[model samples]
Target: MKSCLVVDDSKVIRKVARHILETLDFSVEEAEDGRQALDRCAAQMPDVVLLDWNMPVMGGMEFLRNLRQQDFDTQPKVVFCTTENDVAHIRAALDAGADEFVMKPFDRETLESKLQIVGVA
Candidate 1:
C-alpha cells in the first residue's frame, strides 16, 4: 500500500486526514509538527506528505526545503495543506518543492484529486 504522512498541529485534522487516506488504501502516519514529520521521513519516507503551513516547531516551507535537500530512494511528494490561500503562499510552497496544494477544510474528493495530481493516489 502507498504510505502517507499527515503533518498537522491539530489532532482533529490529522484524524480526518488519516481516515480519508486509509480509505484510499494509504498506510497513514501522523506528525504534530514539521520536526517530527522530518524524523518520520528519515526513518521511512512515505509516498506523499500532507503538510500544514504553520506549526510550532518548523513550518511547512522550512520542512519542504529540508526535505528536498535529503537524498532518498524516491523523494516523497509534498502537498501543502493549509488555510493560506494567497498567491504568495502558494507560490512559496511550490518554490519550496511542494508537488501540490490543498486548502483547509478539505474533503475526500479534494484530497483524492490533489493526491492523484501528485501521482500518490
Candidate 2:
C-alpha cells in the first residue's frame, strides 16, 4: 500500500487526515510537528507528506527546506496543506520543493486531487 505522513499540530486535523488517507488506500502516519515529521521520514520515508504551515517545534517551510536537503532513495512528494492562501506562500512552497498545495479545511476530494496532481494517489 502507499504510505503518507500527515503533519499537523492539531490532533483533530491529524485524525481527520488519517481517516481520509486511509479510505484512499494509503497507509497513514501522523506527526504533531515538523521535527517529528522529519524523524519519521528518516526512519521510513512515506510516498507523500501532508504538511501544515504552523507548528510549535518546527514550521512546514523549515521542514520542507530540510527535507529537500536529505538524501533518500526516492524523495517524498510534499503536499503543503495550510491556511496561508497567498500567492507568495504558494510560490514559496512550490519553490521549497513542495509538489502541490492545498488549503486548510480540506475535504477528501480536495486532498485526493492534490495527491493525484503530485502523482502519489
lDDT of each: 0.94, 0.95
TM-score of 1: 0.98
**Candidate 1 ranges beyond 4 A from true positions:** none
Task: Compute the lDDT for candidate 1.
Answer: 0.94
Q: Against the hidden reference, what TM-scores do the models get?
A: 0.98, 0.98
In candidate 2, what are the lDDT values of residues 1-121, reduced to their tens digit? 9999999999999999999999999999999999999999999999999999999989999999999998877799999999999999999999999999999899999999999999989
Number of backbone-clashing residue pairs for each candidate, in the order shown: 0, 0
